[model samples]
Target chain A: MFDFNIVTQWLDTLLMSFLPAWATVLIECVLVALAIITLYAVFAIVMIYMERKVCAWFQCRLGPDRVGPWGLLQVFCDVLKMMTKEIVNFRKTDQLLHRAAPFLVVTASMVTFSCLPWNKGAQIIDFNVGVFFFLAISSIGVVGILLAGWSANNKYSLIGAMRSGAQIISYELSIGMIMLAMICLTGTMSFSEICQQQENLGWNIIRGHVPAVLCFILYLIAGNAECNRGPFDMPEAESELTAGYHTEYSGMDFGYYYLAEYMNLFICAGIAATIFLGGWAAPLIPDWEMWNEIMLYVPGFVWFLMKVFFVLMLLLWERWTFPRLRIDQLLNLEWKYMLPMTMALLVVMAICVSFGFIWN
Target chain B: MENKSYFSGLFSGIKSLCTGLKVTGRELFTKKVTERYPENRKNNTVSERFRGVLAMPHNENNEHKCVGCGICEMNCPNGTIKVESEMVEVDGKKKKQLVRYIYDHGSCIYCMLCTRSCPHGAITFQPEFESAVFSREALVKQLNKPGSKCAEKPAPARPAVAPKPATTADVTTPVAPAAPESDDKVAKLVAAAKKAADNAAAAKVAAEEAAAKAAAAPEDADLKAAADEAAAKAAKLAIVADNVAKKVAEAQA
Candidate 1:
């Protein structure tokens, strides 16, 4: 981002000199939004490729190898294929919502990125109620999924959307609880502030002890559930729902659901890194100035990516390894098991925070 | 149910999931079951008993064991095999020889009926199952060479019965005459037949005398004498054939 930083600074100075301040800010905001969209597309492609390779390895099979080396270009080729395919609509459907559903889903997922902390000062916006906004905006994607299913007038899609709505709403409780646990530990809602606080302390996982680790585990399961992936992927259960909400979708509309799904997974993993695993923060060896200085040679963005990839690997590992949980089982697990467990962990964590046991 | 508490049940569920994950994690190191087909074709070998296409077993001399008996063709349920034979001159004698052995591979359902029904152990199932063809015509193959005849021939025992002509006549007479005719016609027929019979008898007696003489004579001279006697016998048979033809013509008139 050297040139990107330089070019953006140059544009800002140029705009400030010539254009009205409001117009300059407005155009700059649009450019940043556009950049976020591009990031979503690129991140979706990378995650999809990684998923294919990792899932293949888990099953003792070779993944795509025909395109670029180790099939790195497979996603690009798939994108081309999806773009060229005709978007087929069904006989009886609400054309407006059916067509609008995917973009809505994608936008909901993309908006959450404005509050994400990639590195120190690398966030798009530092909202005072950032964590709340993240939770609220991300959950809005369920509406898109519901509309996708309901608008298509497909029974399977309707069931899928309904499941997605239920699953996301249920899992949202546990995910928010885990975030609250982290928030309690960090004492901030802004992503960069939370991350900076983690840098001050070691990490929430270390300071909050066992409860923090439990919170991490609970978050992993619920976040995966929220994204509607394997194991927790009952809504899009291919055997059950065909494609869940996106069954009637074709061509790029179908592609959009996939993009949103995988990109959502990426953010979930990124957030996990940010909250529990200490996003972009290397472990500190205190009183060793030489080693610390050498460690600084590694960029924070790379550390962020490495942590994200680790989380992704965990997601992939769990997906390939486990059979899908039944609908009743999924609800029961969340309501009966994860909900109570996460709530208990949060109370434990709150005690730890109050007693000054968690390092500031 | 074990009546387990919520915490205990949750722990057990996660434990089971972890166990399954462990299995897949171990499998991550295992070799894959799929072989890229076209690239790995050279490494493939079908089993010995694999029934692919019908073929005839040929010796090192390029001579196949199929005798054009049409037994395989008859036994084929789908009419896939077609055997056609025609009379051909071989070794100066007219013999029924194999003209074509058309095998329609497209119609063959890989039923080993044709291979099993062959009496001479002639048909075999060649294990070459990459048998896709561009056109149906490409699958219809001729399995034998042109004018291919059976290797085994039976021709030498006709004269051995001359010593027991009474029995031989009983077996041979009715085979030629289908009706009772007028006395003159019967006499002519008998005369013509008797002349033919006398010629065969004389030839037999001469053959026996020549055999005895050859046994007593020197080796080189005996072979020359045998060759001369064979020519004389062949000529006498030609004369008999002409007299029989005249007798048949007279009867028709």
Candidate 2:
């Protein structure tokens, strides 16, 4: 779909001739890593600005409007500010863990982006069990949050870390079950294969019918909670925790956590878009090959970005509109409300699949 | 019953949330109520009486109403508005003209006391509200133009003392009737009057001699009656002379 593969192939042949087999592989991995990091930085700038603009619009305000034309340069100016700010040292704290925590967080989010498909066959990795790997890898961000809180040696950070741990663990189960429902329908553990299944069998949200719709809603709610955003963002709740686990962090140290949170949001939105909205696949308009050709002229990456940003806007709308959930209420929402419903929907879908009622 | 209530409560929560989204969604499509700030300055307006900063307004001819009485300087609570006036030759007169109306906008509190107390209404707070600037010195500006006086006024146009010059010149220059400064001229005129009185007495005696000769030669009753009428006229003239001396003495007092 893009010239990225052509460049990758050229680099692979060039690296292979100059170095040993393993060294060439290592060099390729380094290149991909560099590309993902660059994407992460760009994604953070765009997402932060979008979030601020969305929040401002909901409240009838013009957000960040003085930096450049319509405040387009605000993110760059803020990043510069964060980079130049001094990192403050904590008294009587675990220095090593504190230093390693932000790196761990940013790394986890960057790794998650590797599994997401930007266009057809343009993903960084196409490993089998990509969904399982993504689920497992994304949960590791909470460990960084916990480390940052514990190593800071502050009471609020510790409480926030504990809350985040509980919140992520609670939401992860429902998200897992919802994904399981969608996964059974696709009958695969690989992302590319799963995306291809949707393309062949009409997108899962339509293929799985009502069950897919239920899963989509439940998945978004759980995903929102999983990222600790909006009503579910109790751990780093501004009113309660004064900014949660990274309270003691200053400068780029705090900025790393911020970047991680936004990256997590984008990946979640992208995953939602990929699994449900047909990753980079144009909307089907049957019996019109000319129309299909016209749509493809717009490119798959633009469609992918449109769907991703649409999902991101949905998340932002909920964040700005909903009030913060209390810690007990957050857990109650998962265990009492979402879990039982997810289980019932799974049983109903299993029976439908066995009976051969499910169709594209 | 309990299970139904739980389901109902969840439904109600979702419904309320949907309601909130509806309001926000409706507003999203509606025209934004927020100003784009610097872009919106063209449309917005300050209040009619909003005193943003002190300013001296000039007419099209580059003239203002300030006569440089320093009244606004005295009326300002913070002494923010200073009037620096140099005496200039306007119309061949040493008139106190306004060289500079120093309006220190940085220190102004906008109390409206200076505008209210300005007698000629020369200085006022204009409705232009975008007064913020980078430096304090940029706010200090000379308001009135140096070359011209007020359009609605002549030179030295202090309202309190404007009419005094013309009226006082008319009253003082016309007469020394009640002034002691003209005493020397009055005394020289009185000496001249006494000499004129002696000459008149000598002329009257000569005329009386000529009249006696004519009367004695004619020897007629009609001529004797004419002499009696002349004696009566002389008596009336003597009465007028007594009143003039009395009036002159009263003026000297």
Candidate 3:
């Protein structure tokens, strides 16, 4: 009922009829860019607020409730405060790379966000290698993190950046293998195609049974590690590294990193929603036509968001619940355990896919 | 066995993680412990014993318990308290009255010495923690309100274990009541005790006087009579002293 394609299509057609083709394409690009930026701002504000509340609730404390009703406008106030703050410059720092780092990280997050199939016909870019594209773009953020750390001319930043580099790089393997296993089941790397296939094949987790479930669990673990959130947040270990890679960052420069972190969380959850949980697909009750019909009537956009938020909550739950892992333990978890498990699971998924043992 | 242990270890690790999540999950829906201060100031309460600031409480009649003994000032390690007093005529008698009970809250370590050391229980810590002020002078508070009078009735002093009664009637009342004949006997005993006490005192004075006169006039005839009189007095005083000690021991028993 609330499909966003109708508005987007109408806008596209309206612009096409009144303007030149080049100008129309340019306007569409500008609109999409504006939409993505606006989405980033909204998500950053929302996720930060949600995370604070979740963290507070877990600790038996009431979170922010002063700025606006339920502290809804707290993030906006924080943004304003951050904007007016002085981006302090260090004497011996590499000014150029330090300045460019936040932009790079934010750009990487935005690019990855565009690749996700938000709803049917609502995706910004429907790349054939969408999953691979997401993986590639997301890893580019680590480069920005490393640059920020190294250029800060500080020991803490250097160590934090180095730790982040090691953790993200290693965990990326497990993440890739899990996605590969999913792709093996669906026979496509394109997120939209995988999502559509899951709708027909009764959600990959349901169809592939054991291996798929294993894939989902491993993917959450790997994705969590990839995001550099606890229990895998070794680089920006606040207790040890004093905000890790972004130690020297201040003002809106630091705000970018902060925004990107939350946005990265959304992206991680979004990927999980698209791959394992059927992106934009309404949850159906087996053998219950009435329930299926009712669920199907709800907008795909709403379903997509519900799944994303569910995954986001799971990530938030674990983040608040678990303590930060030691650096050695982090690396050991990936290399000795998660990576090997993903590899074994990928093989099992391959066999299941070849034997046509899927549920649907 | 090795493989079994490995799998069990992994399973237990995941289970432990789930257990942690469950604890926080349960806490998430539980009632939050946050007290929104300032907004909830109306509902906020502090412990009765919370030492926030020194205050001398006044009754409805605006009378305080401070006697201005300066004990609190003496006990204060940081010179946080200053108790000043002035002698004022009350019913034609000079009485030390509290003029200013200056309490420098700025310098107060909140060691509770001032409150604990107040002999009259005059000063106590009031749980009014919002004592922040802009001016340094504001922290130096005068605990005694202006135009307030000192409480007329002092707090009752602690009772002692034993008391000395002056009269026979007073002594008999503290002890168990006896027969009417015993009351008369007690009175006569008390009269005799009083006489013995006076004679002992007189003998002591005479003995001293005789000794001094003997030392002055070695060949005087009256010196022998005076010595003899002193010796007789001493002997009688000794007898009286023994009888008084026996009566005192009997009374105690």
Each candidate: fraction of true contacts kept? 0.79, 0.44, 0.94
Write one digit per residue (lDDT tens) for candidate 1, span B205-241: 6666666666666576856679577658946764674
| Alpha carbon lDDT at A240, candidate 1 | 71
Instruction: State the local distance difference test value for candidate 1.
Output: 0.80
Q: Over the stretch A1-360, how does candidate 2's per-residue lDDT look in tens digits?
A: 343467677888998988999999988888878888888899999999999988888887777888899899999999999999999997788999999999998888888988898777678877788889989999889899999999999999999999999999888889888878777777787787776676566787887888889888888888899888987889988877898899999999999999989989999999998888888777666677888678767666788899999999888888888889899989999999999989888887787777766867
Error of 3 at B202 (Å): 38
Error of 2 at A10 (Å): 5.0
Clashing pairs in 2: none
TM-score of chain B of 2: 0.48
Clashing pairs in 3: none
Return the lDDT, model 3, position A334.
89
Query: In model 2, which runs have C-alpha deviations exceeding 4 angstroms?
Result: A1-11, A17-19, B1-4, B46-253
Which of candidates 1 and 3 reaches a greater DockQ? Answer: 3
iRMS per model in Å: 1.1, 1.4, 0.5
- Model 1 CAPRI quality: medium
For candidate 1, list the clashing residue pairs, or say none.
none
Rank ordering of all candidates by lDDT, starting from the highest = 3, 1, 2
- Pitting candidate 1 against candidate 2, the one with the higher lDDT is 1
Predicted chain B of candidate 1, TM-score versus the true chain B: 0.47
What is the Å distance of residue B113 in model 2 from its true position? 16
